[model samples]
Target: QIVRAGAPYYLPAKIAEHVSMVGELLQFPRLVPKKVISVGSPVKWANSCDARGCANLVTPSVIAQRYKLPDESLPAAHQAHTSNSMAVAEFQGQFWKKSDLDGFGTSCHRDVSVAKTIGDEEPHGGIESELDIEYIKAVAPEIPLTVIYNGQFSLLKWANQISSMADP
Candidate 1:
């Protein structure tokens, strides 16, 4: 039942994907979630929990980060600072207006490339794989960039993925 909730109790590298895949393969979504009338035996619904709002769930640090100031301050440093930036207006007028985003791209655009090159091939560049960094640069041009490379034995693979997608 805990596996059904996609909860990894100890490690982040749990294979919950396979479990979910098997559940889907067996048409479990259509079969499960029938609320019962009487239950003397031990039973638990995976997603049974109190509903939470942003006020209850968010932290002070998260609030600060979410409402952080833009790179360049605008006319007034209010909540609408980014929206009121002159640069944004100019960018919108010159670049955004001219470009046809009718079929520009989807909200989530990603390109993943793997390299088998040895780690010590180029020590001058940071730990991040050069091929991967270059791929991201070419794909998402003219934006703030941060690259994070992880060792093969690192525990938090999710953090590595998050760092790669940090800019976007």
Candidate 2:
């Protein structure tokens, strides 16, 4: 049995997609639907035995109860209501708003081109320079403009480097 009860951040859409793809590729005649059990309250161990690890099974509810989390704001404490899970085919949608950039300041929008080429320059101009501000202003008069950096890979590389330092 699969248990998917937690905050939306921990659940991703790719898991269900991958499972579907694998089943299709393998040509499974009948796919078995798995049971997804969501426990409303987090489980806590009564004894001090550490088989699976002390924190593994300890639910957010138990933490909230012990630490006294507010009842009205206990959605974060209630593990089952947080996560979206699929037993066989479907998956959960993105939890965060689709922003132009993530916390790392990487642009999510793709480059929009005008013509194939403009004034002997590439349509979007050189990478470092901003798009022709006056031309864009004339075309899109009302919109406030800002430059966004497409630096996802660089951010990831920096994150990896920082994470590696924690290794023994």
TM-score, one value per model:
0.21, 0.16
Q: List model 2 lDDT by residue over 98-157, tens digit each.
A: 121121122211222222111122223231233243223222223343332232324444
lDDT of 1 at 127: 21
On residues 51-95, what C-alpha lDDT tens digit does candidate 1 reach at each position? 243233332223333557232223342234222211110111121
Worst 10 residues of 2 by lDDT: 86-95
Error of 1 at 156 (Å): 2.5
Kindly report which residue pairs in candidate 1 clash with one another. Answer: none
As a whole number from 0 to 100, the lDDT of residue 126 in candidate 2 is: 33
